[model samples]
Target: MKSTLNKTDEVNGTIVIELEKADYQENVDKSLNQFRQRANIPGFRQGKVPKSLIQKLYGKAVKADEINKIVTDEVGNFIRDNKLKILGEPLPDNSDEKLVDLENDEILKFYFDVALTPEFDLPLDKSVELTCHKVLLEENLLDEQMDAYKKNYGTYLSVEDEAKDTDLIKGTLTELSDSEDKDNLQVIENAILMPSYIKDEEIKSSFTGSKAGDKVVFNPKKAYDNNEAEIASLLQTTKDKVKNIDSDFSLEIKEVTRYQEAEMNQELFDRVLGEGVVTTEEEFRTRIKSELEKQFKPNADHLFIHEARDIIVEKMKEVKFPDEFLKRWLLETGENRTSEQVEDDYPKILEDLKFHIAKQKIAEENNISVEFADIEALAAEVAKAQFAQYGMTNLPADVLQNYTKSMLEKEETVQNLYDKATEDKIIDWLKENVTVIEKEISSKEFNDLMNERTRLQEEN
Candidate 1:
């Protein structure tokens, strides 16, 4: 067998594989004998089936299969031996019209088309300048975060006085009707209500200064502006059922519960930052500032990387790709994707592909590699960020490690983590090589900058 690559252009090529009968005749004969041993004929025993009969029956199919295997192996070997940087898998040349005639031909030829990656020069040095925004943690921002912690660690108290807008009011809700007969009306016992959620002003005012044992009559549908989900929850029924009821409901108030914010004391600190983590308010504030910085680091890194990508991509404006071949390859490989859809998304796909190629080239030049430990560490950081979203910021190291371990057990999760870890390493390398100007800005300014960038991206 002989396999050779003919370059049609810089980024496109065709590999022709010529095979002789000797290459697959032995495998074909061996398969025929196996089939002969397994055959059950009418006039002959299984092992005694005639070789000629077996050859005639399965020869073409066996020969085609053997030739296909040989072609695939040869193509793979040729690509590896030549160190070709191919874009996608090689496809059968759609323009090639030659058909394999296993019964008549002793030598067969096959054509496969390959798209090679275009090579370009990447200028990676201090010449590339990027701005890194350092978001300043203002005093007011710290106070706001402290207030959130206070609210999260607050206590609920049952009050016996007026029902405030923010108070949780427990009552028995009974539907009122004009008819003297009230037996068929819906009644939800122990129904919880929040006066603040009432959409209608007059209906909400009726609950003002409402104390225990007071009965307030109002239309549930009208009070919430006919919100199906809210009415359903208050009436303890489905949204469909809530639509049928439009009568006034009498709520016999049982108790009013108010959420009281925790005082800025040692106990509050312990609850927010874990046991004995901070003893005084000064220490607590200092620790909170540190935690905020840690939380903001990822965001800052993301912004830096985003800007770095644009800078690097702008420098690579002259890079090229095998556009026509890739379009055909995409149309063939994509599941149930139409040409119109591929055309619509191809530009974005091409841009992403270019960035990917650039990143790979950078990694190759720097000898940057990701290990299991790198992935594990990034996974742990991810786990911490997830838990921090729910105010569980100070989770134990062992707990975070276990969560990360559980996440890495899934193959898809490991792959995703690996990709993220690799990108992070690349970003670090860029930060070291490129000229990064760090500017400390207020949180609001930083947010506005990010929002402006996002708006510009969306417009583009």
Candidate 2:
């Protein structure tokens, strides 16, 4: 057997592998013998089947299998031995596969196309300048966040005064009836109503400024604009049960509940940030400011990446790839993807591939790694974010650890954690090594800049 590579350029090449019958004859013979021993024909006993019959029956298949295994092993070994820096995997030349004739051919030849990664040193050292925006914790922003916390910790209280539109009115719903049947006068005891939800101005006005114990009579269908779902929810019944009935209901306001915002005290801090985390209002405000800054770091990092990508891609434009070979490989590997689709998506794919290559090079050169501890930490951050979405900002350490551990048990979750950690490490490294010009900007300005960048990207 003889194998050699022919290079067309630094980033593209082909390899030709020539093999004689000796390459696979021994393996083919051994396979045929094994088949003969396992054979159980009608006229022959097991282990006594003739080699000639076995060879005639399964000769081509066994030979093909052996040759294929030999070719795969040879190619893999050659790549490793040569320390080749390849991009996509080596593809079979001209076709996806070949069927060789062992009966007539004394020798066989195969061709495989290979691509090498284009080499370019990125200008990503201390000379590279990037701007990292620090969002100012403006007074209004802090006040807005404080309001959300107050609402979350607010208490419901009964109101003896006039009914307000936003207030919750709890009362008894008594269905009025014109007929003699008492059963038809359906009364849902302890039913709650929020008059603000009434669509009709005339019906909603009747409940305004109404004190407790005041009885209000209104047609449900007309108040709700004939929406059975809203009427059924207000009446505490299924939509199907009230789809056709249109009648007036008497609501005797039993109670008016109003939400009272929690005061900025030790109790509020304890509830939001866990017990004893902050005992004073000043400390609570400071902590909130720190958290806001931490949350905004990802956004700032995103903006920096977006700003740096164009510069780096332009710098590395001279680096090339084996475009023809890659297009063929992509079409072959993709699931039901057409040539036209590949053509249209290739430019974006190439840009992303270039960005990834640059990032990977930096990570590899700096010995950046994502350890189990890093992944666990990232999983905890993710778990905390998930809880925050449902109004849970604080959790016990044991409970949070257990939840994150459960998340890491899944393959996909662990992989995502790994990716996130690696990216964070890379961002940190870039911030440290590159010239980062710290900029203080209001939240509005930061958001407008991001929106403008997005618009420009979409335009391009």
Candidate 3:
């Protein structure tokens, strides 16, 4: 068998596979023999069918299968042997070939179209400069975090004073009678409500400053803005049942629970920062500022990578791609798009494709790789970050392990974790070799910069 690649240019080519009769004749015979052993005929026992009769019965089908196998193997071998950098999977050649005369000809030929990766020079040195911002923890941000930690660790205390908006009110809700019969009222015992969460300001204020045993009448539908879940929970009924409830209900306050921030003592310190991490209030505040700074690293790294990508894309704008082949590929590969639609969407696709090409080249040049452990570690990190978003920091290791394990069980999640791990490793390497200019900026300024960046992208 002889196979060869005919290239029109750097980004387009055709692979021609020529298969000799000898290459497939043996397999055809083996297949025929197997068929003969399994054949059931009217006047012949199994395994007693003659080879000539078998060939006559199944010769063309066996020949076609053998030729297909040979052509596929030959095409693949040619690509691997030549180390061809391909853009997408090879497609059947556009021009149809008439079938080879299987009975007389001793050779069969097949043709396939292929797209090659665009050639471009990659720079992985200090020449690529990026400005990275150091987010300074402002006083208000730190204070907010401190307040959150204190409140999150706080306990609810029963108060005899009037109920505030932030206080949790425990009460019994009863449907008020429209007529003079008070005995016909429907009641729910031990209902819970927080005045601050009530949607209507007028209704929320009515409950505010109400002491124990104080009864307030309000329409449940208006108080919660017709929120089905809230109304159902308030009346201890199902959402389906809430649809018909349009009456005013009386909520008699049974108990008012006020939440107070935890004191900055040794126990609070131990709980917030782990045991013995900090001893005093000053130490705790300082450590919190530092922790906030560390927490912002992922955001900073994201911006840095974006900066590098913008620079790289601008520098490689003149590089050419195989427009014809790419357009054809977009139309194929299970995408339900017309040629015109593909043309309209091709620019954005090309931009991302160019960046991916650059990233892959850098990874290949540096021998960067992602192992299973890398994926697992990234999963754990992501789980922790999500937990921290909810202010549940420093979770037990076993709990994190369980989350990571569950995440890896999903195919999509595993793919995302793999991508995140690869990006992190590549960025880490880039920071060491690239020129990263660090500049301190306030959180507000950083946010404004991000907003401006987003605006510019939208305009483009």
RMSD of each: 5.4, 4.2, 5.0
Off by over 4 Å in 1: 37-48, 94-99, 157-259, 293-296, 336-346, 452-460
lDDT to native, each model: 0.87, 0.84, 0.86
Report the number of the highest-lDDT candidate.
1
C-alpha positional error of residue 364 in candidate 3 after TM-score superposition, expressed in Å: 1.9
Give each model a TM-score. Answer: 0.74, 0.81, 0.76
Model with the higher TM-score, candidate 1 or 2:
2
Q: Which 10-residue window of candidate 1 scores lowest in summed lDDT?
A: 93-102
Tell me the TM-score of model 3.
0.76
Q: Candidate 3 at 303: error in angstroms?
A: 2.5
For model 3, residues 121-198, the per-residue Cα lDDT tens digits are 866688878888899989999899989999899998899998999999998888976688778577988988999999
Question: What is the C-alpha lDDT profile of model 1 across 1-460, one tens digit per residue?
Answer: 8888899989999999998988888988988889999999899998998899988888778878877888899999999999989998899975536766667777788888999999899897898888877777889988998998889889889998798998998989888888999789888889998899999999898887898899999998899999999999898888998778889899999989999999999889887788999899999999987777677777788788878777767877777789888999999999999999889989878877888989999899999999999988888888987888777877887898889889999999999999888888998898899898998988778778778878987986
Worst 10 residues of 3 by lDDT: 93-102
Looking at model 2, which ten-residue stretch has the lowest summed lDDT? 94-103
Where is model 3 more than 4 Å wrong at Cα?
29-62, 96-104, 118-120, 160-256, 317-320, 458-460
Residue 248 lDDT (model 2): 89
